[model samples]
Target: MSAPATAAQPSTFSRFLAPVLLVAAMWVIQFVDAVLPLSFTGFGLRSWDLQGLLGIVLGPLLHANWAHLIANTGPLLVLGCLVAVEGAVRFWTVTAFAAVIGGLGTWLFNAPGTLTVGASVLVFGYFGYVVLRVFSPARLAHRLLYAAIALIVIVLYGGAMLGGVFDAAAGVSWQAHLFGAIGGGLAALGGRRRAVSA
Candidate 1:
């Protein structure tokens, strides 16, 4: 008797639907922010304010304006797709870890009274993950990928750091960037072991 037909593997688009849906949901909420005077800041438990918990999950979706949201969407979309490709389980794991750690990093390291906002921390985390994934000793890729990541970091963050030094009001949270990168590094190390085992 013929063996039962195996189910076909889903297409790349199908695999990516989860992240895409999330991105769309974020976009919709951003639009809602434009029209509504809603702020979660005053609604939750006093001890656990907006910046404490909701900020970790919802902060990425809330933006200062269209330009800010646009600035973040591209990197988020690209890196998120790559993470999902690693497998749904790993994708969610990295995302949840990055968001929580990045938020806590902001809470702990940010200057007191400073109102931190935006998804840039998570963006940096995504970049960190990519770097670790490429540079891991067990990865099946050529050395060029690792070199490219190094070059990208130097060209991008290096310039941003130097610029931050001169422009005091640039308002970019280099601390969040730093902590998110560290968080991503830790997550990557854990993920690397899984890759090696696989």
Candidate 2:
């Protein structure tokens, strides 16, 4: 007798695929940019230029250079996975918020025609979401757990988070960091409202 066909099982790490894909794409883009003689920074977000607005969507995916991407990789994987813990859908959603908010803020605030690029925007977004979420969730157990996690995230990234927005370092886009965080806070509030309604 022929054996029945078996269904494929989902991997435990499937939820992490989105962030993994993001990181992988970053590495690939950097590699290609490095190998080619042409630079890709021109494709990054250009402040106050209508023609450059497309960079809002394109900017996060492009980085200035290997050093920039490398600096962003670790915290991204950590906080990104934290966001992904909700699901891949939420992960991408938060990323969208971060990109748009970060993009618009930088465009409006930075020197006209200035360029910005990198994943730090999403990093700040994810950080804000995780911290803001500590107040949400219906159950005490969940709230407490979130509180603990939030505390840990604070200890680890709090300095960088504050520094990113307030440091005013040369070549840094505090606008991206600030708006990214605002976007993340909005996402958390939106989720809380949904939970309340449901």
Candidate 3:
């Protein structure tokens, strides 16, 4: 009898494939923007465009340019790993919640008539989730995680925030950051409550 066919090796596409494909798509969009200079506004979802709402949802998958995407890549990989560990269901739940809520917050409060684009809001939301999870009282593991996240934030955003107070180009929306952080905190708390009830 012919030897039993070994189960097909899992495709590389099965591992990190989703996120990789997503990042690749983002890169393509950015590249097209560079070559064609397509307006970043209303990429076919006008009424739903809802200003930077697209940024909150599709933002994580889009970038201002290669440099901007590159700057975000490391964090995206790290946070995506963490969420993946949390399992697909919870991972998607946290991400979707953060994006929707963070986007809504930005839409409600961003400078009038100004449309924002990019995944900075979702990125900030991931950062916030990491920060809150590390500090959440749900588990000892979370405490350690929180401490590490705090260190990262201090290392990354501490000086940037101070600079924003003085620099004009630092017109970064502190609001998006604030709401993203809030969404993360809320997600962590909700997760903790569910764990306790269970």
Candidate 4:
């Protein structure tokens, strides 16, 4: 008797679909924001406001303007795809960690009434995950490969990541960047434990 056919793995393009669709959604939302009479930015994370708590879920999906979204698109796609390469679940898990932790941290730390919005939180989160994954418990070969990838990611984004957290200009929220990175690192370490137990 012939063996049952094996399940086909997803295509490389399919693996990347999540981030692409996320960027597309950002663009579409920006278009709608521009054409409509309403301001979506108001829905973003507001410090010390009870109603603003919803921004933890909505803030990353909104942007200040086309410039803000444009600035975030490249890094989001690059770092997002890096995380997605593991699988869509990992990608979204990292995203949720970054959004919730980063948003809460920003809300708690930013001056009262300060409004924060953008995908930069996730960008920094992905950056953190990629770098910290190097230390995840794994086979030596896998750890080495992760080390190489982490090195490359650091070379590419280290300066910007540092600036995002430590040298942000007026009106920028460094708290979000710092806490987003913390969230990603936590996800990486948490995943390490899971992998060991599995």
Candidate 5:
């Protein structure tokens, strides 16, 4: 008998699509803001303002500055691609949870009128999902792969991730980091359930 055909790996284009769109959007918004002499940051998550509630949708798209967006781009691509390996559906589901949860947390906990912006919420959330996934009840092989990937992620970003949440410096919203992680955990568990059911 002929050998069974293996499933195809996710295409590079498929993996990169979402992240590229996200990064491109940030850059385009930044470009417009730079040329117009108006800061788009006010559109970010502003605490305690009824109108600021809109930020829950817009926050991740607006960055404080070029430097801020640049800083988040790399981690966003790396971790976002990891999630994308499962396809866009999973990637966006985790992203929605992260942004909504992270944004709400910041809105409730961060100082009123403070403008919180950056893709760090997504970055931290992706980190949480990637790391927590190792402990999920998937097939042994899948879990082992997750464990290896998690270990590598930990060694690279562990300290930074910890500092991001608990040891946040001034101007950083620890609430977003902490809650984004919470959201990521929720996604990981949700994903595991779906996987097992399938």
Candidate 6:
């Protein structure tokens, strides 16, 4: 008799592909911008400009320079992979929440005509999601596991995350960091509700 089939397993690569693709897109766009005469930063979110509202969707995909993209790359990959541990859907959901909320907050609060671009918003969002996920509804064992992971994340990124929101220097958008974090927290809470209801 043939052995019964076992369930397929998710590969390590598939789990982390989303963040890799995002960073790759940013790099590719930056390359094109560097090679061409045209500038893409103009497409970044501009405070209080009606036409600039489109930046909400495009801003994180663009960056001010190679240095800016490099700075955001590590954190985005690390925290994004952590969030993606839940699944690709969950990963995209948190990203959407962070981008929209972070973008809107930046648009409303920054100086008019001020332009913002970078993946720092998503970086902050993923950080918040990882930290707050400990509070999400789950079985005791699962909650403990999440708590352990959250503690480690906090220890690693806590100081930088705080500085990002409260000690932002000139040219940095603290509003995006703060609101992106709020978006992440909301996603965590939303997960709790879904778990409880189920």
Report lDDT per candidate.
Answer: 0.64, 0.88, 0.60, 0.90, 0.87, 0.90
**TM-score between candidate 4 and the true structure:** 0.95
Give candidate 4's whole-model lDDT: 0.90
What is the C-alpha lDDT profile of model 1 across 1-198, one tens digit per residue? 765555455567776776677678767867877778875323211112444556667665566667877877877777667667666666677776677787777666666555556666666676667667665665446447665765676476556534433452566666666666666667788876876688
Give stretches of model 3 more than 4 Å off: 1-19, 41-55, 135-171
Which lDDT tens digits does candidate 3 get at residues 45-123?
1123454344556655655557767866766666655554555555566667666776677667766644545555555
Clashes of 3: 3
Measured against the true structure, the TM-scores of the candidates, in listed sequence, are 0.75, 0.92, 0.70, 0.95, 0.91, 0.94
- Residue by residue across 4-100, what tens digits does model 5's lDDT show? 5543556668776987788898899999989996788888888999999888888888888889889899889899888888788889999998999
lDDT of 6 at 42: 97
Stretch of 10 with least lDDT, candidate 4: 1-10
Can you give the lDDT of residue 3 in candidate 6?
53
lDDT of 2 at 38: 91
Candidate 6 error regions (>4 Å) = 1-9
Clashes of 5: 0
RMSD of candidates 1 onward, in order: 4.1, 3.5, 5.6, 1.6, 2.8, 1.9
Task: List ranges where model 1 is wrong by over 4 Å.
Answer: 1-8, 40-51, 137-169, 195-198
User: Candidates sorted by TM-score, descending order?
Assistant: 4, 6, 2, 5, 1, 3
Model 2 C-alpha RMSD to native: 3.5
Q: Which pairs clash in model 2?
A: none
Candidate 6 lDDT tens digits, 109-161: 99999999999899998988888898887888988998999899899999999
The candidate, 1 or 4, that scores higher on lDDT is 4
